[model samples]
Target chain A: MSIPLTLVLGGARSGKSRYAEGLVTAGPAPWVYVATAQAFDDEMVARIARHRADRADGWQTVEAPLDLAGALDAAPAGATVLVDCLTLWLTNLMLGEHGITAAIEALEAALDRRAAPVVLVANEVGLGIVPDNALARAFRDEAGRLNQRLAARAGRVLFLAAGLPLTLK
Target chain B: MSIPLTLVLGGARSGKSRYAEGLVTAGPAPWVYVATAQAFDDEMVARIARHRADRADGWQTVEAPLDLAGALDAAPAGATVLVDCLTLWLTNLMLGEHGITAAIEALEAALDRRAAPVVLVANEVGLGIVPDNALARAFRDEAGRLNQRLAARAGRVLFLAAGLPLTLK
Candidate 1:
């Protein structure tokens, strides 16, 4: 079967990450954890450690704070690749002045070429009050657009909250 | 004068989080950091820790992975408050059988009651490929609708990438 891509999305602390981990653990083939976070300080270092401790011993971890497509290229075929989160990755790209259109194309191309199942993690940001500042409001708009693009490509979608998972794909 | 509500948005690692923190640090009152992340494992713990270390001293931190409205309500009026991100929060609400309409209403109401300048962080997810799954497609659609609604009401909008901020509101 062609690789299936699942998108896991939720608010912070809504159990999206946990749910995504479970899905990979239960699925077939070699499991790989593709982490998008960079350790900028002590708090992040500890957070990364905790995540490492939580994963199964067999799971291989790949730290790709910005170059996701390149990271995916390095993953073996027939493996199960779980991207810890896409939001952080996107943030990295956006801040670098990388073309959003090109970055997205690279990700999709990699996904299409990969033979393993891909699960992407993301956050949903539009269900809140309108922001009053220009910068904040613009970000909300862009995030909404990006989420739409990723979700459209995902084969399955799940929303998590309170450690609960709901299938939306 | 009413307290201004700011929406901060960017792709992952775009320095939006740090930027948000800077905005709050510049505020006149003691700032509050409303965290929405949950530690299900070591990785998340490290992520949270990194965020904590990034903050300056004397900032009150509140961990509310869910129940954002309640957290907002609990914050003292006239105190500068920062919601680390909204995408996760929305996913939290949506995963628990919460309809988009209700969630938006609740957020709007809570925002109306706030007396301090509130800075909200969110990730941009719409600038990518169309998902193949129904659930992800639905999320994308809903997020878009929600962002549009919020943007209509927000006083300011900004897009950040590579730590650079662009005004759009």
Candidate 2:
């Protein structure tokens, strides 16, 4: 069967993760949750715990902070896979001083070869004032470019706001 | 005839301002540009100057850092008014220790009573990760709420991305 790829975009606390979870849960069991966030600080630890509590059983969690494309390649065929976010993955790459273009190219290639349906969540962060710092501005620009690329490739694209989803493509 | 109100929302450099200008210029000649930005830094001064140069002739510019409602009220009847942004105005009010709730109420009241058609441009800033600082978190929360309120009142609401307009309402 041809694998379906979906991209979900939203702002902070826009209920995008929950909405993406709903989409995957409605399709198949034995879901794989590819968590891209790392526990760098106490606040992140708490946030991660909250996300963990929000998910029910039947989810196989994989901690793929950097090797997202590899994780997708290893997932079982026909079982739905969800990458909780792309922005966090981007953050991990930037802080790790990894080449962003190469990583994104690998991710796109992996998505192309994946056998199972994959849903990706990302933040829409460029719609605000330019960040006061150069690092932040660069990150926002990268996020915007990344989102555009994913949205173009995904079979479905959604923008979430206030817990509601608007189909973009 | 009753006044028409439009709200154009987008991310940083998403061409929202240019799109908003097109909407106004399509209707009439004498356009009022309500700039809510305060040129505090060199970067901002340059940005403001760029925006000024981008605008065409037959434009009346009003600098309203904090008193947006007053500026709207003082605009000539039956003319077109474009409020460049709301987020900057909100920031001004917050830093100035102005009452947010009262000010929003006054702005909404003014919008309702204005005789001129008003087009507003605002940034959608809540679609990213939770801000690390309390002040930034507060600003994002306030921006989200303000966008919701304005969208509710707007006769036409649009979400712009990649220089394209998506009619939200």
Candidate 3:
């Protein structure tokens, strides 16, 4: 049987991570928490540490800022995977100059191989004023494109605002 | 009868303006286009021009770059009003050092006086990575608060992504 994919998309502080975590912890314990964040500074370090401390017991954390597909593939059999975010992963790919299209394909293939349901979280970055820098603009466009692509294939899609869920699909 | 207010919230290029226009035109002719954009540079001018050129006939355009409340109050009795966006109006307010709280309250009061239906468009600016500057951060926060506030009272609220609407209320 095929596994289901749920994409939770929202803005900063919109409770996307918490919401996705709820979905993960809802089913069973020993959930796989795939962390895409890479802490380079104090702010990011604190954010990462906070997320780690906030999660309840029975979560197996996997740090995969760049190797998300590999991380997903390495998950234990029949484990529900919750990728807390793809935006940071995409940021890492872009900053590290990785081939994004190929990485996306690999991630998709890994998702296809999963035996358990998976939920992916991403940010909706294209709804505001255009960013000043060219790189930010390109990133926003790519992020929006990636979101639309995944949303099309996901079994369920949600747009979150102020901690409320609006089912998009 | 009390007027109905619909708030269309979306990211940049998320088809917010187009979708809100559809709602306005669905009612009757001679609709009011309450524009809140100020053309200070080539980009701004170009954007305003493009939006102006994109609209269909029967739109009575009103330049309300700063006085959106006044514009709304004067939107011809029984005319269905479409405010292309509030983010820009907020920008103008902040730039002019206007009292944002009072402005918002006045705008809400103006909305209450409408004898016909009204549709408001706004950008969802809080979803992406936090901005670098304090001013931008404050703006984002205010925009979000404004959206949440209006959305609470709005008869209908929509969040747009990839040009698709997800009902939030």
- lDDT of all predictions: 0.75, 0.87, 0.88
Native contacts retained per candidate?
0.00, 0.25, 0.40
Q: Report RMSD (Å) for each prediction in the order shown.
A: 17.6, 6.6, 6.2
Error of 3 at B144 (Å): 11
Predicted complexes: DockQ each: 0.02, 0.18, 0.26
Q: How far does residue A78 in candidate 2 sit from its true spot (Å)?
A: 1.3
Question: Model 3, B80-105: lDDT tens per residue?
Answer: 99997899999999999999999999
Winner by DockQ between candidate 2 and candidate 1: 2
TM-score of each: 0.50, 0.60, 0.60
- Per-residue alpha-carbon lDDT of candidate 1 for residues B32-103, written as tens digits (9 for 90 to 100): 889887777775687789889988897999987777788889998878889877766666656666766876
DockQ of candidate 3 is 0.26
Task: For candidate 3, report its TM-score.
Answer: 0.60
lDDT tens digits by residue: candidate 2, A36-103: 99999999999999999999788999999999989988888777999989999999999999999999
Q: What is the per-residue lDDT of model 2 for residues B1-169, given as tens digits with 9 covering 90 to 100?
A: 2558899998875568988999999997678999999999886788799889999888999999999999998888877999999988999999999999999999998998987689999998876667678888899999999999999888899987634567999
Comparing 1 with 2 on lDDT, the higher-scoring candidate is 2
Whose DockQ is greatest here? 3
Lowest summed lDDT across 10 adjacent residues in model 3 chain B is found at B159-168
